[model samples]
Target chain A: MEEFEPKIVAFCCHFCAYSAADLAGSMRLQYAPNIRIVEMPCSGTIDHRVLLKALEDGADGVFVAGCMEGDCHFLKGNYRAKRRVSHVKDLLRAIGLEPERLEMYNLSAAMGPRFAEIANEMTARVKGLGPSPFRKQTGGDA
Target chain B: MIVAEQKPLAEIAGMIGDCRKVLFAGCAGCVTVCLSGGEKETEVMATALRMKRQLEGNPLETVTYTATRQCDPEYVDAMADVVKGVDAVVSLACGVGPQYLAARYPDLWVIPAQNTTFAGGSKEHGVWEEFCGLCGQCVLHLTGGICPVIRCSKSILNGPCGGSQYGKCEIGKDVECAWHLIYERLKRLDRLDLMRQYREPKDWSKARDGGPRKVTREDVMIG
Candidate 1:
C-alpha cells in the first residue's frame, strides 16, 4: 500500500513567510512538496473559517506563518494572527480533531532555511498523525 | 452591549442530531456587537454545522438568516416562511433571541448557540467588561459617568470602603475600584462637592426584585 500523503494547507503572510518561501526556492533549498501555500496580505487575514474549511476539505493539517513578534509590517497583524490560530485550534479540538493539526510560526522574510525546516517539520508531524477524522464522519445527518 | 460565548460544539451538535433541515439564526443587536452572533457569525456557524454534519455521515440542509433584532416579534415573524420544513433552529443570538423564537414559534424547537454572560461594553478587541447592572435606574450623572453599581466589586454607593490600594480594588488585582474612577471624574469636572452628599439605599424593588417589571407610556397608547 502507498504511504498516506497528507494534504497540508499553509497560510503564509506575504511580508514574511511567503517571501521566505520565495527565498527558499531562490536559494535552491529542499523542502517537502506536499504542502499547498496560500498567500495573504497579512497573517491577520487568516480567519477561523479558513482553517476549518481546510480541515473540512480533508486536509490532514493546517498552519499560519507570520512575521516575528513585533515585526509585522502592519504593527499587530501577527498578534491578531496568533489569537485566530489559537481560536481555530480550540474549535478543532472541540470537534475531536487534534489541536496539533494546526500550528502558528513566526520567521523573517530572509529566513529561507527556516521555511524549508518548517515544511519538513510539519510534514513529519502530520505523517505521524494519520488522516483527519473529519474526512469520514460528517457532523449530523445526510 | 452584551457579552456572550459560544456553547461547546458537542453540546450544540447533540441538539440537532439527525436533523437534515436546520436554521442558523443571528441577531444584529447585542450578539453582533459582541462578535458572537452577527450575520458573519451566522454564516460561520452555518458552515461549521454543515461541515460537521457532513463528517458525521449526516449531511444537513442549512439555511441562515440574521434579523435586525432577534428580540423583536416582527423580525421573528418574518422568519415564518424561512422556518417551514426546517427540523430545528440554532440561534446564534444572545439569551433573549432564542427565548423569543421559542415563544413566537412554539411548534419549532429552538436551540441557543451562545451562553449570554452579562450586559457589558467592549474593553478592547475581543474583551468585554460588565458596565450596566440594569438596576432599572440610571445614576451615571451622580457618579460622574462611572458606574459604581457594576464596576465596583462591592457595588459601594457612597464611596470606597478604604480597601483601595494603588488604584486597584482590595479584593483582587483584576477589579478596578469604581469609586476611584468616580473621584477622578468628579475632580476633573470640578464637581467634587457632588460626592460629599450622602445617598439613600438603592430601591431593590425596582430592580430584579420587581419580578418581570413592565412600563407603559400613556401618550403612546392607542385609543
Candidate 2:
C-alpha cells in the first residue's frame, strides 16, 4: 500500500517564509512537494477562518510560517499569528481533530535550508498522522 | 456594548440535531466589537460545523450572512432570503439576535451560538467586564460613574457592606467594592454631601417586572 501523502497548506509570510521558500529554490534545496503555500503580507493576516477553511476544504494539515521571535516585518504580526495558531489548535482539539495537524513555525528569510527542512519536516509529521479525518467527509462537501 | 461568549461546540452541535444544513446569522454590532459574533466568526463557525458534521459521516451544508444589527427588525428581515435555503438558523450574536431571527421567521428553527453574558466594555484586549445591569433605570449620576448594581456583585444600594475590606468586596479580593469606589469618586468631586441623604428603596417595577416591559414613543410611530 502506498503511504499516505498529506496535503499541507502553509500560510507563509511574504517577508519571511515565502522569501525563504524562494531562496530554497534558488539554492537547489529539495523538499517534499506536499505543501501548497498561501503568501500573505504578514502572518498576522492569516485569520482563524482561513486555517479552518483549509481543513474544511480537505487539506490534511495546515501551518503558519512567519518571522522569528521579535523579528516580524510588521512589528507584532508574527506574535499575533502565534496567538491565533494556538487558538486554532485548541479549536481543532475540541472538534476531535488532531491538534498536530495544525502548527506554527518561525524562520527568517535567510534560512533557505531551514525552509526546505520545515517543508520536509511538516510533510513527514502529517504523513504519519495519515489523511485528515475530514478528507473523505469534506471532499465532496467542499 | 453587549458581551457574549460562544457556546461550547458540543452544546451547539446537540442543538443542531438531525439538521443537514443551516444558516449562520452573524451581527455586526456590539457582538462584533466584543469578538463573539461577526462576519469572521460567522464563517469560522460555519466551517467548523461543516467539518464536524462531515467527520460524523453526516455532511452539513452551511450558509452565512452578517447583518448590520440583529437586534433591529430591519436587519433580521435581510436574512429572509438566506433562511429559505437552509434547515435551521444559528445566530452568532448575543441572545437578542436569535430572538429577533426567531420572531421574524416563526416557522424556522433558530438556535443561539453564543451565551449573552452582560452589558459591558472591554478591560483589555480580550477581557470584558460587565458595567451595566440594564435595570431600565440609569443611576450613574448618583454613583459617580461606576455602577454598583452590577459591579457590586451584591447590588447593594447603600453599602460598602460589612464585607468590604480594603476597598475590595468580601466575595473576593479581586472584586472591587462598589461603595468604596463611590465614596472615593464623590470625595474627589467634593460632592460628599450627596452621600449624606438617606436613600429611599428603588421601585423594582421599572425593571422587567411587569411581564416584559415596553416604552412606547408615539412620536416615532409609523402609520
| Candidate with maximal TM-score | 2
Residue-wise C-alpha lDDT for candidate 2, range B103-172, written one tens digit per residue: 8998999999999999999999999999998777878888888787789988877776899989999989
Give per-residue CA lDDT, model 1, range A1-142, as digits (tens).
8686777889999999999999999999999987799999999888877888788777888999999999999999999999989987877666657889899999999999999999999999999998776654443211
Among incorrect, acceptable, medium and high, the docking class of model 2 is medium
Tens-place lDDT digits, model 1, residues B87-121:
89999998889899999999999999999999988
TM-score of 2: 0.93
Error of 1 at A136 (Å): 7.4
List the global CA lDDT of all models: 0.87, 0.89
Quote the TM-score that chain A achieves in each candidate: 0.93, 0.94
Best by lDDT: 2
